[model samples]
Target: MEDAKLTPRKLATRIGVAPKTVERWLADAELLPHARNRVDACRALKVDEDMIWPKAVQERVKTGHDRELAHAYPYRSACPSTVWGELIAGASTDIFFAGYTNYFVWLEQAAFIETLRRKIVSGCRVRFLLGDPDGEVTRQREAIEDVALSVGTRIRISLEHLGRLGPLDGLETRFSSPEDAVNHVSLSVFRFDHDALVTPHLARLVGHDSPLLHLRRQGDSGMFDRFAEHAEELWDRGVPQTP
Candidate 1:
């Protein structure tokens, strides 16, 4: 039943929960999770309250949900039939692979870095394949190495040139050959479990749109598989070199 437009104090008493608790729940990052969960629970309990909620309260929730969706990354899987309904619950995870470095800086994404560190420290397999091996690239690599180490985590990289990439501090770097060759710009995909975020801005800004990395959409697993195969082949074919 919809709430009978009770005042905040009355609603709090009716629910046996504090007003602040209700307000906090409504303000949560993933707000609707509890609404949904509560709906189910109330149905099972056969309890119904006033069916009308105040228009203002409803408007607040609608606005909050819209803001979150516009700002957050999206992922949906048809095969799995699941959605990360962003309510007042919590944020979810995302995995990213980029051919250009600009996107990393573009998002001002300290969140991504921390998530990566958490995944590695928790024993999740993670790797970053940087594009091209040049002198300036080597220095940039060192900076990333320091960042990861400072957090007591490690990032494994498969450098295409140098012999068995180098071991910096405790991080492992190896030179790998082309696992496959391609004539187009591939994609930069960020995955969270069965979901992913794919964008072209990174490669576009850096001018790496060489058909081999044309990241666009994430709804196609077949396309993603093909990209992965090509990258692996190229890495396999590349010869090791030192910077």
Candidate 2:
């Protein structure tokens, strides 16, 4: 206040607050002014808001279990296509699509095969962990969904697209183990390096209809790591696609 040549009354007048309120804010470090008052005071003092109320700024920022969550979509289809394009383009090290069918990328991402080829040629480790089309779990899910485009058909479509890639080095495709089929079918985790898009399939709902969580890695044991670990575990037990 002295540096700004601002008295309690003067600062109060500038921020449109009572002089006693300004005095209270000055008297107690724990007391914080209203957000607007804080911003006005900072401008009047030619300082940053945090320079005056560090605690308030800290309290306003997300720094908990949900800190890693970048976005949430009530339905997977609601998330913008640009987000997927950005994640895929930004990833340089790893791109693991651990969806049960893994068919949507072919439709959603234009020139997806070309993208994968380029990513592989550039040293990215691309992996697809999919469900077995002929497996009993696939049959069961198809019956549950009762859709014209069956679950098994969807898995086959992904396999067909993957087959076209023609066994490039650093690109691997596998079917989740029979025992893990149920769990794999219930959740889809598509990871692009440190960022992940996760979906937990709701009963009787398709993958696109499920809710999605977009997570960015913040720490070793954050939400991103948890989902990444789950995908890795399934991949470890997966059956390699037959040549």
Candidate 3:
């Protein structure tokens, strides 16, 4: 059977609604990627000036794709109340963090990071791969250094810089495919001691759990390997984003 293809307006007509309504869903919701193309086609199919959705509609769809990845990943949660539990309470997470002037920003999880620090104090093999340009990461590293200095041999840090890379995560993370979309997120990725992913987004930017998408299992194994290699390669490069 041929694939179903319909203009957003035609789809709206078939579904007995206004074209703008269709555009609304496309712009303001967690729509599938194909919906991206669909929205463009639909906008072009505008019956008249009144029928055309705002250009912002389609652009917002593109701009918000990063925020929409969470909807693609399946989220699992439990009442165990562990640091990981709260982070994964939804299906998937896409963290949008804005780094400071020139430092990486850890996804918004003060509680979880604090928990990880306790784990580190207990001799956990803690490794952090911070993006060099991120001011947040730089400040956070200073904070860690202060703690380490105070501890004075109680905790040992094994630091390896990954220079300046888009999106950051701790080591031991199984790197995945790059998001082939625009990203408004400042904080890219965060993991809890290499167990689960952590991402930070400004609350209320999107509705509750709106950007938290269920991720599809990747079909390309090579993509995963390439991603892993790229991350490791960057770590080896170790060119800081600053002078």
Q: Which one is best on lDDT?
A: 2
Arranged by TM-score, best first: 2, 1, 3
Q: Give residue 171's lDDT in candidate 1 (0 to 100).
A: 24
Best-matching candidate per TM-score: 2
For candidate 2, write residues 103-176 as lDDT tens digits: 88899999999999999999999999999999999999999999999999998988888889858999999999
Q: What TM-score would candidate 2 get against the native? A: 0.76
What stretches of model 2 exceed 4 Å from their correct place? 1-60
RMSD of 1: 12.4
Q: What is the per-residue lDDT of model 1 for residues 38-143, given as tens digits with 9 covering 90 to 100? A: 4543443355412222332454343331222222332212111122222101223323343322222223333444544455455444333344433343344435
Give the C-alpha miss distance for residue 150 in model 2, angstroms. 0.7
Worst 10 residues of 1 by lDDT: 80-89
The alpha-carbon lDDT assigned to residue 101 of candidate 1 equals: 29
Candidates 2 and 3 compared: the better one by TM-score is: 2
- TM-score of each candidate? 0.34, 0.76, 0.27
